[model samples]
Target: MNKIVDLTLNYTNDFTGFSKETSRTIKKDGWNASILTFYSHCGTHMDAPIHFNVSQQTIDKIPVSDFVGKAWVIDVREVGSKGLITVNHIPNDVLNDFVSGDSLVFWTGWSQYVNIPKYRDELPRISKDLANWCVDNKVKMIGVEPPSVADVNNIEEVTKIHQILLKSVVIIEGLTNLEKLQSNCVELIALPLKIEGGDGSPARVIAIEKQ
Candidate 1:
């Protein structure tokens, strides 16, 4: 048996990086629909190398198979707001078992602040050392509950961290519900919208835990 968990935030009128307006109604237009506008980097989104000028790759250019992989969720909830997480924070067992092409997810417990201002402004970020480790180890992707892997407020820090990781690994941010997963490792499938020449796009992410 296996359990599935949705790791994406519910997009709504109040959700960041998204705006929705009713365009049709069932009673009037005989159908229901809305006009959706999404921010490329907002709300459970995936980033392509072009996002940081690291490369010319776009969200649509990514192979669909690259979006799915085995992910090891590292519990990093102890890192507080605006905390810089280094490679040392990752347990030795995870480092020993984590192999090339496997993704790494950080369970920072920051999604609880999704509705407030703190979620983006005071997010925990990955340090440069950790970013180098991801690239050095050939991690396929890095997922975090925060909107960005680096400090969003710092121009230099954010740019440097993103460039390092974007050079080799895909990035998935604004993930939620990691606490519900019972296993440390799971199959993660994160599919992003195929927007032509787009640097990023909102993604629907999920984790399958084997029972």
Candidate 2:
């Protein structure tokens, strides 16, 4: 048996700061479909290197294998709101447990603040040093339970961290319901829309736990 956990945030008008209107619906037009107006980076999404580097690979150019991998969750929720997440927050055992090419997801418990101002203002951020650590360790990707992996309040620092991580790893942001995962290790599948030359795209991220 396999238990699938959805690690995606439900999209709402408030989610992407976009006004969504329906020109067609099952009740009105005999089908359920609506035009969506939202940023590619909005909601649970994967950031490609092109998001930071114009000359880098786009969302479509990234290989499909990168979207699927063995992932482990690290519980860092002990860090409070607006806390700084350094390598010290992670123990040596947890750091050493990771093998190269593994997807590391941070369970920061910040998804509860989704759609709120605190989601961006009070969200905890991964430090530059920690981002560099991931690079040095050859981590394939990093996911977080916040709107961003970096401090949204500090644009420069956010850019720096993104640059550091995007150099070698895929950055997955805005994940929710990570606390529902019962296994430390799971199969992570986060496939983004293959938009040509897209910087980023909202992704449907899920974790599969085998029983």
Candidate 3:
């Protein structure tokens, strides 16, 4: 039998620019209702090219097929904080498993800091070399257990990395629970909310392990 693993972080009020406020109390309205206010890029989200450039593609323009595919989770937990996650981090055997259109997610074990201040601080970021490798290998999409693929402190590099991958591969960031998945290879489905002309959207990511 196969099992499904939810790879998303639950959206909460504490997250930056996120709020679920009561619009009507159950006792007063006889029903439960709330108003949600959040940045489109809040929580576990997928970024579009438009995020880096206003004229570039938006999340709504990306094909649904790009959000789901055969995936491999490359474990790079050993790469410490603010470390560059280079191609060397992946073993040769694991590196050879990549194929065109394959979705790849890195398991850096950073999800544990979700509720901590360090969560948004320095994080293991993908190196330019690895980003180039993904492009050369024709990868379809990439996901990470960090807020962004590039160092958030370096706006220039962040934009560069996003531009590189956005040219071909979709980028999924702020992913959590990647450790709960037992299989290296699984079907990845990370669908983001469709916001017209929006740069990105929070997403619900999941993995389906094959039997």
- TM-score of each model, paired residue for residue: 0.98, 0.93, 0.95
Question: How does each model score on lDDT?
Answer: 0.93, 0.87, 0.87
Q: Pick the lDDT winner.
A: 1
Mind giving the per-residue lDDT tens digits that candidate 2 earns over 1-211?
A: 8999999988888775545787788888899777778798888999989787834799999889888898888889988798778888776776778789988898999999888788888889898898998899888879998889888778898899999998888889999998899988899999999999899999999999989
lDDT by residue (1-211, candidate 3, tens digit) is 9999999999998788799999998799889899999898778999988888734688898999899999988889888799898888777777777779998899999888886766768789988888988888888889999888988888888888887777788999999888788889999999999989979999999999987
In terms of TM-score, how similar is model 3 to the real structure? Answer: 0.95
Scanning candidate 3 in windows of ten residues, the lowest lDDT window is 48-57
**Best-performing candidate as measured by TM-score:** 1
**Model 1, 57-157: lDDT tens per residue?**
99899989889999999999999999988899888998899899999999999999997989989999999999999999999989999999998889999
In terms of lDDT, the poorest run of 10 residues in model 2 is: 14-23
Query: How many clashing residue pairs appear in each of the predictions shown?
Result: 0, 0, 0
| Pairs of residues clashing in candidate 3 | none
Indicate the residue-level lDDT of 208 in model 3.
96
